[model samples]
Target: MVKVTFIEHDGKEHEIEAQEGLTLMEVAVKNGVPGIDADCGGACACATCHVYVDEGFKEATGEASPMEESMLDFASERQDNSRLSCQISVSKKLEGMKVKIPEFQG
Candidate 1:
């Protein structure tokens, strides 16, 4: 399992052991982590599953696809580190990764 940390807007942290081949949004939703609404499931059609990838993990999380980039335009509190969690797939290289959930989904 890959370990991932989710930091809520209120500064709450949820450390989850996620299965490989699953998206970060899947781990968030399955583990009941708050602030990751994932309204469009893992389709990358919505930005409700938005998160800010920790700078250190940016390389592992990688850049967003065009479709994901378009969807992120709808997210609130967008940042340089912003990414749609649904677009991030879990993998060994992503172990110990951290993401911060926005205060609102927009």
Candidate 2:
């Protein structure tokens, strides 16, 4: 399991032991982490699963693809570190990664 943390808008933290081969959105949704709507179900078609990747883990998360970047345009409060959780696969490289959920979905 890859260890990851999801920080809620109000600063609540959920530490998760996520299975590899699953998307970060899957981990959050399965763990019932609030604020992750994931309406597109990992299809990269919506911005509801948006999250801010922690700066320290940026390289591990990698850059968003063009499709994802276009989708993120719809995300509310998008930032430099913004990414769609569904687009981020859980892996050993992402162990100990942290992501912040915005106050609102797209």
Top model number, lDDT:
2
Model 2, residue 39: C-alpha shift (Å) = 0.5
User: Model 2 TM-score?
Assistant: 0.98
Candidate 2 on 1-106: residue-level lDDT in tens?
9999999999999999999999999999999999999998999999999999999999988889999999999999999999999999999999899999999999
lDDT agreement with native, every candidate:
0.92, 0.96
The alpha-carbon lDDT assigned to residue 32 of candidate 1 equals 96
* Total backbone collisions for each predicted model: 0, 0
For model 2, the stretches where C-alpha displacement exceeds 4 angstroms are: none
lDDT of 2 at 99: 96
> Model 1 residue 79 lDDT?
96
TM-score of each: 0.97, 0.98
Native-structure RMSD, model 2: 0.5
